[model samples]
Target: MYRREYKVSISNYPYCNKKVDVKKLEEELEQDSNEQKEAVVYIHIPFCAEICDFCIYCHEQVVNNDKIEKYTNALIREIQEYSRKSYVRSLSIKAIYFGGGTPSMLSVNQFDRILSVCKECLNLVSDVEISVEVNVLNATEKKIEQFKYSRVKRISVGIQTFSEKTRETLGLPLKQKDLLNFINMMGQYEFPVMAIDVMYGEPCQEKEEIIQDIEIASDLNISHISLYQLCVIRGTKLFSRMQQFDWVQPDESMLYAMFNVADDTLQKLGFYNTVIPEYSKYGKESVFWKDNFNPQLDRLSFGASAYGYLNGRTYQNVCNVDTYINYLQKFKVPLDSISEKVTVLQKLERDIILQSRTQVIDTKYLEDEYNELYEQMYKETLQEIIDQQLAYREKNLIKFTKPGMYMQEDIAVKFMKSILEGKSRLYKKMVIGNQKI
Candidate 1:
């Protein structure tokens, strides 16, 4: 039993802003490049036909073709500029992902040209896993054909729900019939994976509606199903509507019910839960996602509002489309922020926090690799979770149980909070003891 009251919010999460040092970033990228480490690349397509009120990511509604062409040219120039850098040229890119408002919005020619430019400039591996995000409305036959021709390994389709009520509530354009047709067409394709992205916890969503969405996805020959719980971002239009309508998040009890139902349903449908909210039928998780989240491999990001991590520094590109394009034209990195060099202690904490979210933290691995940063308080925190029966340890591995998964975010946060408090107290004691001496 834990006695403290704590809440997990997007702001308090560790991924928030940190310090930044541009020179250190340059040095780290250079060193990694020299070592010839495997890297991932992410390209952001910020142009969406219609803006979703619930979306928190940076995106602009497309108004003209000229702007798109200008952005595409700028993106190619940026990639070429990176190739000139010693570090970038040295990296063997393992994965490339095109994600955003809707990567499939681009014409086949545009997609091919961008891919060609990347291949010309970067040291892309032979079996690189290229993935593209597709809006259900945008997943035309021609686009699917383009993906096949481009050797794309996976396609992530955004079909948040199958319920007309929920879809209407979320202001989604198409109806259930449109998604059914899209699925039928996708079944004809030979893509390695076609993952469906679904969401739960909408104000108008019924339990049956969510279950129906999963059932529909399971019936299709889709390779994976990604089910996300809706988060009401603070500044988004959805959040404002919540206040006006007196809407609240589904209570914890209801949320847990939804999660368990989806987990159980997907598991029965032959989908392996690779990570919470992500299930794969073939048991192959996205290399880019794993690389990016694990924060060990270097990943480069291009285009507006794209975020990437390299050499322990996380960075985001400028969100404004015109500004990002202009800066690239001037031969500048369109970075909105480059986080400071992460301290070893922060790195250790991050590993524990992130691993705890979806998988076990291999205690033995941590001790062997990061013993210096693995302090007594950290170990004690791990012990507290075991003692509280929130997590179990076997040999060298520590993992949360099924019931514990629902509370995983809070568990990790509380443990981290306790470790930080202990550090504060110890520092205070050292100061007092020094005065006495």
Candidate 2:
């Protein structure tokens, strides 16, 4: 099985014609002295009982209880150190997402302690959405109860596929029975939101298997469904075994077919809001999907390998757990990488990209705000995409046609290329210095 990779050219597109003065924009934003913005915090708990072959997140396989304890303590120390330096004042936490390597692997008591620390460090809203990512292997009735008590209103469970063969290939823990039981338990708790993460295009997955997984998820009445396409990230076990496993990813035609099937099925079942490439649901109440396109809400991240966007800059913590812990021990911020401060123009572009992912972008507003960029880079490409039925354009809004949503990343790159090629003066050393974990 061979997977075909598609390349989209940005040079010839109508939207790729613009030149942006990156340096000028950056200086203007800095001179304005804008107040810092409130942000959502993402805490990455990178410990798992077993390493899934397809997982690329920074996580270590926990060998014993001692390692878990140490990791929890390190996380607390890191949080305290960051709070003191950042002086988290009245800035309310919009969302606190505990992601990666199975945060549910921590004991109930450990989770409580961590949540307690978070509350003390930041100003939290009454309806602040707190989410934890859990693997089915670690998710249990007891764990769900603990999460609810901890004020965690949302749960995202990893149930990549219902097929046993695919599970083996992905090296995921939990049997079909275990997964079903977990879903039933979650229903009992009726957590405000219950999301399941499923993967398509795995080595052992077929079109029919994908359909079956969606049907099962819908039957369970989960609040949201994140249907991800499998990608073999560099350095992952799956990437190494790609050849041996005869893994086959869907071709363009097959991918298009898969998307249609999912879109139709999920929508018919009332999961109409397409949150991202891999996510959709039936409601407006979810924090995960709420105001995702808003430019005002900044994203804050913690733990190894997590990234945060705050004020006008983006920062990433050290990716190595040991190094991150060591820095915390010395009472230092453990950030290892940072991107150039985000400019107002860049933020506008980000807002456009995020909105475009939902298959709807207000072209008029974008054109009015980024008139120069529209003339330079997006005009031809936008028309071309619309002509191809990949996107639909009205007076001021250009939205992805169903097919365009699957290739949103490619579209983004095309837009970014125009900026990258024309703006040599925009490039600068990152404020946090370049460090790879």
Candidate 3:
């Protein structure tokens, strides 16, 4: 079972198993405020015009206008409350992200209203990169117009595969015209980063179809392409639907072949997305991606089921929409849980795994910051992966090979497995938060 979890998302590492108290966490934030010099704000909208079956994100169908309006009010209140805090008031906002069930579910006014409040209340920097995740319904001219002269610098859409049959299998709405028009209108605006998310390795999926999706999107003035591997989480509607398929589903080899094919296809078209799935044109990358790992920034996430990190502790908001609103109505914090303080070793481990997204690791920095022993053990682990042809060492740097890039999560797991097998000194200190920490 431990071996099976080798491919788990590194973002979820230093996993929390113990229950957390909301009031205690509130106090922790207050204490961390002095240390939190900068911030990245994430607003979560839980309503969607429609729900996709394969999505594991916290989301629900938009039942009515009343629910959305109320949720919007709660989000504004949350932001307002945070802005008044000593920590938030003292810090500068480096990035603002509107992620969601479908951020487009909010009216252009509602979206702008929230943005307006964030700008008015928070201490945002001049170059603060604001990003929003929109859905298919956001294809309207009205929606695209809302971004004109506004602060949102990045727009992300889930274009998961263009094949009609695959669309039905994944349970996305069938209207491609809306999506195309949305892209066309959005293309008119030159946001620094406009990305379309596409998935591969699905039932009855073909290379030709995936390639077409990439080409069409890239031609539509997309600045970035985020390639996702279709992993149907258990209990999702699509998870059950996939089991009903008659043909042999995608296996490891097929998944790798499809990914490599897409990589080649995108490279031919001038995208720089080699190391990780996020490929971009014009030397651009998402600001939120870099800030998420930065030790100096605290990501304060609002709304239902949003995750945030601050002062070495990661936390999440309530998943229940009504409950979230009720807590905020009384000016209370609606928290689900938070992890215990992250140790220095765990922090380095996290930095290693996530920096893999860039496909390079600086061993010199590790030795200098942590210790020579840690750097040595990490190199040993890299050597083990090198033996398997997933990564290689060049002087003081460790970099991922093509296959390693495709299987990033699994390689991160392999690092943990290596630590447990032979590097007990480091693993012990990592788990206990001792010695150097």
Candidate 4:
């Protein structure tokens, strides 16, 4: 909040050094701890027909039919294993998201088989938000029809940018004209939500390109838009080719301008920012995006490179397809890592961070619930941010200005660090206990 060099570190998931205790996870689920939450599922289909330069998410290109069949079988078996756990039986599934390299690439029969297992195993609640990610190339009418038959609530298509040059630069194989036609065709259907992804801050894209992307999406009558900024992550193909292309990353000022344009233009067009990147016409309830954005909701993930959150812990499956299949077939949970228990302070910070990403944080609840800690945060963290013109309080709600949204992560981190350093009265009272004061 003070714009110091200090960083705020909140534990979304804690790291444990010991070997993963698969049996321990099962035991906790079977015992039915008081903290058990209604869970959501994130199934990762890590196969793409081709890889994009900017994509750093764990994935592989479609290689063979046997591998796909093997992966699908393993994924089902993994879900069944969770079904056998006691806590899972008691919990009602809020949503199930099929995300990945290309979930829609699976055959219709494969979709039926996997969904049938979900019907048999999980307590899928009525009106569940069943969403699937589909690449435009693979978003066939047959597949869309299959999604409809399966009662999928939303379809996510990532159209990073409409610029043919940019798309080609990103390694997209489809022609720009064909891509537009495909999206239009999908929108004509009666799906509950047809969300499209528009990206900004790419290597050579200007602000006008971003505006055009938004304009095109709006024209298509797309129900939702996920506006994202391009990032050059380490270990990605983009990172490796940064020098070859002489990719000039946009400075903070340029990036902020792009964000403001998108935010203003989209809002005027009747789409509000539901989360950091997602803008929706029907508000927050339109899709299950909230479950992933809100820290309070527990998400259980499956398949290669999938991450899951339960109780106060987070875990991920193995990244390799072969390894994931082997682990599941051998009757072992394909857990690559499991986090340690999250702390109270970390939880508090996460709640504020996630909530404030889209809307203001209502301090009244924090004041009544956390009491002294809330007071301390107000004085040492929140007040300072207000003074810096980063955020403002409207009665009980503290909201970030447009400029502040760009630095949301950094600001959240600063506040958390202040709390950790005992700047709060609550911290001093509970931790130090009048040792010297």
The predictions' CA RMSDs to the true structure, in order, are: 6.0, 6.2, 4.7, 6.0
Write down the lDDT of every candidate, Cα atoms only: 0.74, 0.68, 0.74, 0.74
TM per candidate comes to 0.88, 0.84, 0.88, 0.88
Q: TM-score of model 4 relative to the true fold?
A: 0.88
The deviation in Å at residue 243 for candidate 3 is 2.7
Mind giving the per-residue lDDT tens digits that candidate 1 earns over 239-288? 88888888777776677678778778878878876655478886567776
Model 4: per-residue lDDT, tens digit, 300-402? 7889978777766667678899999999899888887675555666566657766766657778877777788767654467777778788899998888887
Q: Which pairs of residues have clashing backbones in candidate 4?
A: 8-413
lDDT of 2: 0.68
How far off is model 2, as Cα RMSD? 6.2
Candidate 1 lands at a TM-score of 0.88
Candidate 2 vs candidate 3: the lDDT winner is 3
Candidate that beats the other on TM-score, 1 or 4, i.e. the better one: 4
Model 3 over residues 1-437: C-alpha lDDT tens digits?
11222323454444443365546656755653545388788889888887788777788787688888888889899888877766667777888888888888888878888999998999888999988888776546678667766857898987897677888878888567767877777877877778889899888898888899989887787878888887677688887877676534577777778888998888888887533667877577777766665544677888998877766677777889999989889988777777767777667776676667678878887778879657655767777878878888899888887787876776765444323456655464354331111
Residue-wise lDDT of candidate 2 within 272-375, one digit each (tens)?
Answer: 65555445554434564444345566665678877655555555677888888777778767666554555555655666666665677777776787788766
Least accurate 10 contiguous residues by lDDT in model 4: 1-10
